[model samples]
Target chain A: METVLRDAAAASRGAPLRALTVRVGPLSGVVVDSLRFAFESLAPGGPAEGARLVVEETKPAFRCPDCGTLYETPVGDYHCPACDSVRGELVAGNEMELLSIEV
Target chain B: MCESCGCGETNPHLHEHGHGHDHAHGHDHGHDHGHGHVIPVRSSALALNQRLADQNRGWFRAKGWTVYNLLSSPGSGKTALLERTLAAVPGSAALVGDLQTERDADRLRASGAPAVQITTGETCHLDAHMVAHALDKLPADGIRRLFIENVGNLVCPASFDLGEKVRVVLLSVTEGEDKPLKYPVIFREADLVLVTKTDLAAAVGFDRDAALANIRQVAPRAAILDVSAKTGAGLDAWYRWIEAPAS
Candidate 1:
């Protein structure tokens, strides 16, 4: 995290890096809040200091055909409450990426 | 400078003066001074791999193939069942994912079904990107059923979507009947719950009713099938269930 900030700052040449928003999915095994906390703590003294860190949470969407119900499951199960379809379609989740960086 | 201004000097008088300044400055200051070098960055940690996964799903869709993501714990008889299914049903091929080695895939090939082994290296689960890459490298000729036998770990595999038409969750009778109740979320997303290794049920003190009841308690509507890939006891039911029309 410090290295990331340092590299971002080093690349900026003290010009000022703006807001950095990150997309974190539940499946990525990264805790969004913890990452945000780390970023806040590490960003204060570096080029990321006061650099707006926006954390976007991504969740996996699942739909059960048997029950005709669509809902979001936690990082664990994908079962539908109305119908216990173990093989429902996973519409989303498993996302982690750098959306954009403002400098 | 410290001695001249009495700042952190060795004298008690200097300490007193420093304490006084600190106390005096404790009052609220209305002016707000923002810090410099704020990092303005928007990015996802999984952005790179997720892009690849999307492309993979698109590729599978373009080919008109129905992918089944098979998930279960180690020793849940996932590979064994696949072997039996291939033997029973003629038109199925598989891409088996594992941490290392093609042992499972090699065994599967004995059923006269072509299978590609996807070694995940150190990863616990088979993610979308790996499936996509494996699909590109596999022979996509005259195949109707495409099975993605995920690395055997219930926790991690539940989090990924490998673009499967069905995400089948396998449970062995010997593993305890409360498995589904304990892991409801995985069972919740399962299109079908297969209770495997039932041939050894009696020997292993496996309670069929208790397990079924537990699964029912969590996922009452899950299409449950009991089978022993060894004795071929209930595989026909499993095959029929898999071949059932997708509405």
Candidate 2:
């Protein structure tokens, strides 16, 4: 978030940040509530003061190596639902990115 | 707070293309206000940590050291297992992590292995930077086996990769048999699962079969080993497993 804010400040010639959008995935293992709390507590004193943080969580997704089927699971289970195989490779849900910033 | 470039300012100015933003991409220019534009900034939070971890992995490979990350909940006998392993295996070194103690490292050193304590202060887990810094304080040369005892916590330690050759997660019999099911994320990432404190399995009424079944469901790819560090039970097999060349 700080990185995004700095970039936004530079791009907009030091304009106050309005809002920041971030993406959090299930496999990232970061608590979204804690992230929002930390942002709220720390953003009050910086260039991001009074800025709103919008968190968008991405669901865990997996792909079957043998059958080529993409699917989503409840965080921990990696089994392929179509083939009943336990060898589904994770293809998504590990991302933690600052998507965009409004300044 | 950028560590890569020592800019005196707290906010490091990023390069125009640092985040790989492509202006050619589709943009909704409905708003005429130029003061606040939604800049597409796609940047990973863990990019720096992952890069450092890759560097640590390269360093370990160049040094010919087999590094194992040992993780488990508190009171899972991780230190005791390390003590037994160091006593049995020669040319072993350890980097122990804890919130506020040198006690585990002190005990491991007494077991005849050079050990260093990484006091994390209030950090819940050990990152790649901490392990890299601790490597400098210890006699890491010619060490065949490097054991990093992570801070005893199942949830946080599973997120940070310390660039270990293998991750070994421990589950004591004294804990519930459904530990693997309850903490599936850590088990899913474990290369090997050690069922420790086997001597007290019967006394504590620990369901061995149920525990193994749970582990199999969560971590089908992980090799499971049952060992008791107190009585030296199954230590030989564990030692051989560690010494065997990675497949």
Candidate 3:
């Protein structure tokens, strides 16, 4: 979030930011609430102060290495639902991205 | 002054804003501000941490040091296990992290192993930069194994990669059998899971089978070991596992 804010501030030539959008995936291990709380606590009185934080969550998905099946269910268990193979690896939903910023 | 935002004010007034909405794509703004522009930025928040972690990994590899990251919740006996390991293993060093105090590092150093302490202040986890800084305080040569005892946090520590060769997550029997299920991300990323405090398993009514089942379900790839750091039970196997060459 800081990185995006800095980039936004740089692009806008130090203009006060209005809003920032971020994408948080399930496998990112970051709580949305905690991110919001940090932003609220830190963003005040800065270029990002009064800037709204928009969070978009992405659900985790796993792909079976053997059957090459992509499925999203029973997030804790990465086994493929079709073939029941335990060789499934995470293919998506590990992202923590700063998608955009409005300044 | 805020370096990133440059608010210029030392004590900037905080604003109480409403919870923002979740949008799949670009926001549809009904009110058009003449100066408002949407700038796209796709970047990971952990990018800086990861870059430092890669540097740490390269440095460790060049020095031929076998580094292990020990992570667990508070009171999982990480310090005790590290003490025993340092005492038993020759040419081993450690870097212990904590929110405050040098107690763990002091105890580990008492075992005759060169240990450094990293006080994270208010941070819940140790990043690669912190480890890199800690490495500067210790003699890097002649150390066969370097163990990093992370801050006693199961959640935040799981996300920060310290560039260790192996990540060992500890779960004491008293912490309950459902710990793996509750904190599955940590278990899934663990290279090895040590079920510690086995000496009090029966006394604490710990369900060994249930705990094993839960761990297997959540961390199918992680090598699980049951050990009692106090009684010296299973420490030999743990040592052997650590000493084994990376495959």
Off by over 4 Å in 3: A1-4, B1-36, B245-247
DockQ of each: 0.16, 0.51, 0.45
Q: Can you tell me the CAPRI class of model 2?
A: medium
lDDT of 1 at B46: 35
Candidate order by TM-score, highest to lowest? 2, 3, 1
Can you write out model 2's per-residue Cα lDDT over B70-121, one digit (the tens) per residue?
9999999999999999888988999999999899999999998899999988
CA lDDT of every candidate: 0.69, 0.81, 0.81
Q: Evaluate model 3 with DockQ and give the value.
A: 0.45
| lDDT-best of 1 and 2 | 2
TM-score of 2: 0.87
Stretches of model 2 off by over 4 angstroms after superposition: A1-14, B1-36, B245-247
Say which candidate scores most in DockQ: 2
Residues A1-103, model 2: lDDT tens digits:
4554555455444656778888888777778887887787767767678878888998878888889999998866778889978777877787777888786
The C-alpha local distance difference test score for the whole of candidate 1 amounts to 0.69
B27-124: candidate 3 lDDT, tens digit per residue: 55543577667766665667666766887898899988899999999999999999999999998999999999999999999999899999988889
Give chain A TM for each model in order: 0.62, 0.84, 0.83
Per-residue C-alpha lDDT of model 1 across residues A1-103, encoded as one tens digit per residue? 4434543554455545676656666655555777778887888766567877766787877777777788887755566777767555767665544444456
